[model samples]
Target: MGGELTWGLPVILYLFLAGVGAGVGTVSASVLLRGGGGGFGGDHFRLARIGALLSPLPVIVGTTLIVFELGQPSRAFNLFKVINLSPMNIGSWLLLVFICTSVLYALAFLPSFMPEMKHLSDRLERVRRGFAWVNVPMGIGVAVYTGVMLGAMPSRPLWNSPILALLFLISALSTGVAAIILLRAIFRRKSADPATEQGYHQSAYLLTASDVMLIGFELMVIFLFIMFAHLTIGNMKYAVSIILPGGDMAMMFWVWVVLIGLLLPGLAELAYVLPRLLYHRHYAAPVAVEVLVSIGVLIGGFMLRYVIVVAGQVTGPMGI
Candidate 1:
């Protein structure tokens, strides 16, 4: 662990952004499919449309970062020159296909905003949904690939956990949902129509509840990941220790990833939601609180990736 890492911040950002894109893209696709043939312009499709529209932006940015990190842009094109089972090769193809499909998926929703495209957009809804079928799995792949890419690094014990893949996927989905909720909160503010406003309130509650469940699952996986490493021998145990109570990265992991990212969001949502469910209240949580939770979740999500990437590189096989 002496020389500079071939993979660094750019890689981390790529993973983070890609995961966000995948999570949101998958959620958007699910929302559309469940939109009940309302097509893209329907009021119910609004939130999901935000997800669909944003799905590509982060991914595109992440991909661009990856290309820049590659030094020679044309080298990316070389990935297609051969076909092997290598994670790099497979990931390149998966990302390429996903980007293409996601672009189409995003474009198909254009009529939702552009009136001139309504006729064309109407016909493309099925096509968009069809793309969703591919995008959802592809999004999952992109998310899991982020972890697999690290886990594939056999020398890095911290990245060796099988749980990493699942952890990354769960985090991706949680952040994705949080991003959508944040955006909806900002835009919808207060719908003019009572029925629409009420619908949004219910949807916000459901989304928050769903995020709480995801945060729960993510915490479980994080525990399993740490325990799996802690219980192991040699480098693995040493790697896990980096984030343990008094370990080097301990404070960063506990304070940021666990407290702010996972717990706070979970507690915040429960505080707002449980009372409503229990007391049958009709009011929504304050927009500021909801937005704060979303921001915290997204920040926490980024910190998780940063911690893992940096710590893994720092506490590797002792003589890398």
Candidate 2:
């Protein structure tokens, strides 16, 4: 374990941002599909609009960071030169296609803001739907690829588990949901129309509920991650110990990733959600609470990547 690490903050940011973009794109696509003939405007599809408009920038920025990290901007194109089953090659292509499709998907919703594009946008409705379908899997693929990239390195026992990919995917989604909620909270307008206000509340409720479920899944996957490593023999068990109680990364992993990232946010959301879900109470949450919970989840998400990336490097090259 050295004081200096090989892969630094840039890589961690790349992973976190990429996951967020993918998650946002996937959630946006799902929301669009769920709306059926509702299209991409109005109170009902506000979340979709937020998601579609927001998904691509983070990925593009994250990808740029990786390119710079490579020390040669042109090196990135090498991945696209040949097609292979390698995770790097596949991820390169997946990211390229996803960026293009997500941008086009966002364009489809431009009619909402630019009235001049309404006619052209209307003509592309079917194409827009097609992009949505493509986005779901492409977004998912990018998310899963993040973990698979790490897991592919067997010498880094901390990242070698099969469950790692699932963990990353779930975290990506949870954080994505958090991003959308945070944006909605920050920019959300109070509709003077009661019906429209109710629609806004409903959208917030659904996003909150979806995040709660994703947090649950992320927690479960994390538990399985720990158990998988703990149950294994040799280097992996030792690697797992570093993040367990009293271990090197114990406080960071438990406090940041579990408590802050998942539990507190989960409990807060469940508190607001249960009344609406069971007792039929109003579903409105204070803007302050939404902001705090969303920020917490995003912080936790970044820390999770930080800990995993740093820990894998620290614990490894496993006596080869």
Candidate 3:
């Protein structure tokens, strides 16, 4: 069979990018809302503001790229004209919701500094609070649906699994949190408020800590998933060949996907954690490490979707 996947690189990358935006955007919104007096008024609050502001742009652009994938852009109306339980159907709707919510979330933050919007911003904040409730579940649903879109097809042995959605969902959260931490770190170093510096550092550490936990879980799932697929003696088992011991895509899967993407970030996180846990040790990673970890996580997150989408399609169809 031809090595054509239902979803192509553009769509897959689009999916990964959108999930990151939604996850990070929502996290930024929530962080802003949660920070009380010291929160928005403090220097760290500015970082949160920046995160909430910057995080949504990628998602908006990614959604547009997904549209450009069509040979005939005008026919895009066909999608809106039909609705079903299909994974793609669900994903499209979720993207629409995520896009709207993210925009509102970012705008709600304008009043914190924008003097012009101060009046409307108060009411916008209340609306945003309502959306905050909506964004969490919606963002999570979009992340998981990305994998579910690929996983729903039983014919693609490499894609079908309960764990696929779980992996995507967690990756979304990890990237989202990472974006916030990295953005805060950069902004803090550039700013001149001692209070802001401390706040940014504290926020970065907390978000990074959460990211560390999620990344660890994603690693374990990958291990168990490969093991489970390898042990089974059937089409499902054969799918494992693409990445396990030896296969066509093994190098991409192992080195870039696993090592730089997952391991580097995971190890960076480990380095930051181990000294403290075992020896009462602590180290403030230089800005370079923080930036590297963010880049690594983002790459890993996208590569995962790429691998899942491409590898699943490259395999023979059901060995029929």
Candidate 4:
């Protein structure tokens, strides 16, 4: 490990924001495809519209941050000059392609805003559906690439585990759901029409249910990550100790990443979801609760990246 950290907040933010965008874009595309790609005017597709519209910007901003972090924005173009199987090269291209496709995918939904372009909107709806398929895999690739970038560095044993990718992917999805849930809670209109209101509730319920599952998977992956590292010999075992009990990063990992980020949100969501799923009660979580839980998840997601990036650097450049 180095005494001075090479990567700082911008890199950490890049990881978090990129994963969020990937998750949002992926989930958004799936939602649209599930609903059979219609104009965004209907209540059912509101979630999709929100997701599509929100997807690209985070990645764009995150990418910009990374470019600035590099200190020479013009040198960024060098990534494209030589294409290979390297993680950085692949990630740069993946980010570029994803931004383009997601932006176009978002634009397809915007024609609905122009009532006079009804015919254009209808035509683009078909294109939107096609883009949905592409975005799903592209989004996933971007999400996994973030982890892959870290795990590729074997000297950083804490980041060397294969499970890191899965953990990041699941976390990304969870945070994506959280972001969408937060947005819906904030922007949702009080429709006089019962059907429209009901649709909103339904979307909320679905997002909650999905987040619960993602949180559950993230917890399991965390467990596996710890066990995997602990079981390994020498540098790997020593490296992972930072996040274990009594280690340097133990409190941050347990408190921020596990407890606040995962458990509270997961339990809260399950509580809300169970009543609706079992007893058929109307899904009406308080807006405050929704906002808090989503924020917690997002916080947790950021902390996870912070902990991992820092821990990897602080631990040692293991002797090979």
CA lDDT of every candidate: 0.86, 0.89, 0.75, 0.91
Arranged by TM-score with the best first, the candidates are 4, 2, 1, 3
State the displacement of the C-alpha of residue 256, model 2, in Å, after optimal TM-score superposition. 0.9
Candidate 1 C-alpha error for residue 259, in Å: 0.6
TM-score per model over all chains = 0.93, 0.96, 0.89, 0.96
Alpha-carbon lDDT of model 2: 0.89
Q: Candidate 1 at 214: error in angstroms? A: 0.5
lDDT of 1 by residue, 237-273 (tens): 9888989998888999999999999998899998888
Q: Candidate 4, after superposition: displacement of residue 150 in Å?
A: 0.4
Identify the candidate with maximal lDDT: 4
Q: How big is the positional error of residue 301 in model 1, measured in Å on the Cα after superposition?
A: 0.7
For candidate 4, list the clashing residue pairs, or say none.
1-316, 1-317
By summed lDDT, the worst window of 10 consecutive residues in model 3 runs over 35-44
Give, for candidate 4, the lowest lDDT window spanning 10 residues: 35-44
Better of 1 and 4 by TM-score: 4
* Candidate 1 RMSD to the correct structure: 2.0
Query: Which residue runs does candidate 2 get wrong by more than 4 Å?
Result: 35-37, 40-43, 115-117, 317-320
| lDDT order of candidates, top first | 4, 2, 1, 3
